[model samples]
Target: MSRPPRILDGGTGTGLQEAGIAIAEPWLTSAALRDEAGVAALLGVHTGFLRSGSDVLTANTFRTNTRALARMGVAEADRPGYVRRAVDCAVAARAAAGTPHALVAASVAPVEDCYTPSLTPDDDALRREHRWMAGVLADSETDLVLVETQCTRREAVIAVEAAVERGLTAWVSFVVTGAAQLPDGDSLREAARACVEAGAAAVSANCFPHAAVPRALDQLGGLGAAVGVYPNLEDRAALDEWEHSAHSLPPALTPEAFAGLARRWSAEYELAFVGGCCGTGPAHIGALAGLPVGAAS
Candidate 1:
């Protein structure tokens, strides 16, 4: 039998939400570090994915940067501390799992609302903030830095540069709309080009409509760099009144369905990595890990 495909962890925020952990912020990444149960919940989620056979476990540093928490009234002086705490959570979780083969990846999310790329700051702020966060993660002992859910070409370029500057392997992932264009309506090819120009080790599609995966893979395939996908599962749990509504609801992509999709991508398009985004949990990742490797076509 061929070696098993490596799997990445599933969605953290949504997994926490589904587990009855709640924080009242629009961006709840680092806030969970403040709550003891939240930290434990995050650790549990990380350990869960590890036990489920994830090769790479992403740290929960998405909203830990100064610019993002500054919006939630977190002081600039205290922001980086939260990032350290987030890293500690991931490290602790990995150690608890005792999986030496699993590597910890620091998650670098967009500074602005992931749903709105237009809100991405100007070049100056983008460079300043992303560099700061990437530096923090590099110091956190993470194996790789994943700059995910990016939308704009400019930010993607800056983010990938920041990651590469820290001497860490990086993958810049874009979130696309149903039409397979980025949130700002730029072509995915342009975004991939920008990341590659910045020296990203890989380019990926993430946190978008599952139906958008194949189109994105088609666009990203044969781009001369490693390609990956970890698209969002539909049927997200209701976190709050504002986040839960008919408009936001989409069909649920269960773990089995997700595994099958990943298998297809791996077989046909030469996917370098496979995992989940929002609405997925360890169960989803377990299903992915359980896929049997087939003979090459």
Candidate 2:
């Protein structure tokens, strides 16, 4: 019998924004590390997701890497402290929610923007920076490293390798432009295969539209390693708008509607896990947790 799908928590950055935290660059959600109020809001976000029945709570380390921090004018000496704080907040949130058994996955975003693969750094820089990020996560004792929203196959493979080299479990996820393609037009199959070979414990498609999950699964399903998806509940236009605006697009699907799509994906693909991305919240996750596993018609 197939195992039930594990529920990963919904969007962290968006959750922070909804909690009245301003989430703009060059710091993004990582700015939360700078103030007690922001940290408390982050803890509340994680605790809300856990209370909604998520099995994995991703730490808000998505922009705490040295390169990103440097752009934000954070001194190099203080960067690792930010990473540790991100991890500590997640661990503390898990404790606050009374769920010691739940796992904490550290966010490992691409060194550059997730949507612009052309901006990816050279191999040497990619390897060096990812190694530093993974080492810090390992040092902070994260349960796993989630190398997510990777747009280029090369960076994804290197990030996964760095995490695995540190003896940490790695799950690599891509930002796809089409059903079977990464943003740079590389085959999703090829990228997924490369990361898996590089020692990623799982592979996934993330930050795509909810309407695209069926086609995304067509590319991800049947890979020997565990496969999953966490799609945003917004269309292409709205996502693009949100990239330049302070406000996020309202979710196109209600909690029940979003859960319906997740139910189909889980039942049809036997996904290892299912969750939400942008434009999703604890209610969306709670709906996923309530789904019964079975084959979809």
All models: lDDT? 0.79, 0.85
Task: Give the runs in model 1 whose Cα sits over 4 Å from its true position.
Answer: 1-4, 236-251, 291-297
Deviation (Å) of 29 in candidate 2: 1.1
User: Which residue pairs overlap in candidate 2's backbone?
Assistant: none
Candidate 2 residues 238-288, lDDT tens each?
Answer: 345225445555777888888888888888888888898887788888877
Error of 2 at 24 (Å): 1.2
TM-score of 1: 0.90
Give the runs in model 2 whose Cα sits over 4 Å from its true position: 235-242, 291-297
lDDT of 1 by residue, 1-297 (tens): 144446889878776766666644655656578778888888888888888878898999888877878877877788888888888888898889988778888888888877677688999999999999988888887888888888788888898898899898988899888788887789998789778878988889898778778899888866678888888786655543114322223438767788888888888777778888876677778778883323100
Predicted structure with the largest TM-score when compared to the true one? 2
